[model samples]
Target: MARFIVRAIFAALGLWLASRVVPGVRVDDTGSLILAAVLLGLVNAVVRPVVFLLTFPVTLLTLGLFLLVVNAAMIGLVALLLSGFHVDGLLAGIVAAIITGFTSWVAGMVIGDAKRD
Candidate 1:
C-alpha cells in the first residue's frame, strides 16, 4: 500500500524530470503531470508485461535494443491517453522515455532495497 504510493510518487517525479529534459514533451499543468505519471505507471504495470511477452522474440533478435522502442511506445501511449500530456513525435517520445527510465532507475537506487518477504 505505502510502497505502491511511494513508487507512484517516484514515477511522477521521473515524468516531471522527463518533461523538463525532453523537448516536445509537455505537461499542461502540475496536476495533469501528476495524473499522467500515475496513468503511465498503471499502463506500464498493466500493459507492458503483455507487450513484452509478445515481443520477446524481437527483443532477443535486437539484442535487447527493442526495449527502447517498447518504452517509447509506452510513453507515446500515455501521451495519447492523457489530455494534457503531449508528446510531439516518435523522437520526442523516445527521448522522453529514456529520460523517464533513467530517472526512475536512479530514484530506485536512491530509495534503496524494497521490503523482502
Candidate 2:
C-alpha cells in the first residue's frame, strides 16, 4: 500500500535521473515519467525472475555479467511498451538500467533503514 507507492516514487526518481544522465534515454513528461516508473517496477517484478531463470546458465557462464543484459532488456521492454519513454538502443538501455537500478537500490536502503528505526 503505502510502501508500494513509496517504492514507485523512488523508481520514478530513478527514471527521471536516468533521463537526465543517459543521452539516449528520454522521458517525455512528468506524468509519462511516473507511468514509466510504475510499469518498469511491474516489469521487473513479474518478468525479471522468469528471464533470470531462463538465462541462469548464461548468467553463470558470464560470471553474473549477463544480469546486466537482463536488466537492459527489461528497460528496453518498458520503452517498447511506453510511448513517451524511449531508449535509443541496447547500450543506452543498459546504461539507463544501471543508473535506474543504482538509484532504486540507494533509495530502498535509505527507506528501509528508516523503517527499521
Candidate 3:
C-alpha cells in the first residue's frame, strides 16, 4: 500500500513534467494531476494487459515498437475519463508515455521488489 502511494506520487511528478514539457498535454491543476496519476495506475494495471494481448499481432509486427502506442492509448484512456486531463493527439500521448515510462523505470530502481516484514 505504501509502495503504491509512493509510486503514484512519482507518476504524478512525471505527468506534471509532461504537462510542462509537451505542448499538447495539459493538466488543469494539481488535483487533476494527482487524479490522473491514480487513474493511470489503475488503467495500466487492469486494462493494459488486455489491450496488449489484443494488439499482440500488430505489436509483434512492429517489432515491439507498437507498445508505445499501447502505452499512449492507456494514457489517452485516462485523459478520456478525466475532464481536466487532456492529451491533444497521438504524438503528445507518445511523448508523455516516454516521460512516464522513464519515471517508472527510475521508480522501480528506487523501490525494488524486496519485501520487508
**Top lDDT prediction, candidate number:** 3
The number of residue pairs in model 2 that clash at the backbone is 0
What tens-digit string does per-residue lDDT give for candidate 1 at 4-77? 66667877887788788888888899898888888888889999999999999999999998998898899889
Q: What is the C-alpha lDDT profile of model 2 across 1-117, one tens digit per residue?
A: 666778789889988898998899999999899999899889999999999999999999999998889999999999999999999998898888898888888878867855576
Cα TM-score of candidate 1: 0.90
TM-score of each: 0.90, 0.92, 0.95
Please report, in order, the local distance difference test score of every candidate based on alpha carbons: 0.85, 0.89, 0.95
State residue 73's C-alpha deviation in candidate 3, in Å. 0.4
lDDT of 3: 0.95
In candidate 3, the residue pairs with backbone N, CA or C atoms under 3 Å apart (3 or more residues apart, or in different chains) clash, namely none
Candidate 1 vs candidate 2: which has greater lDDT? 2
Off by over 4 Å in 1: 113-117
Worst 10 residues of 2 by lDDT: 108-117
Write the residue-wise lDDT of candidate 3 on 22-102 in tens digits.
999999989999999999999999999999999999999999999999999999999999999999999999999999999
As for model 2, its CA RMSD to the true structure in angstroms is 2.1
Residue 16, model 3: Cα distance from true site in angstroms: 0.5
Colliding residue pairs in candidate 1: none
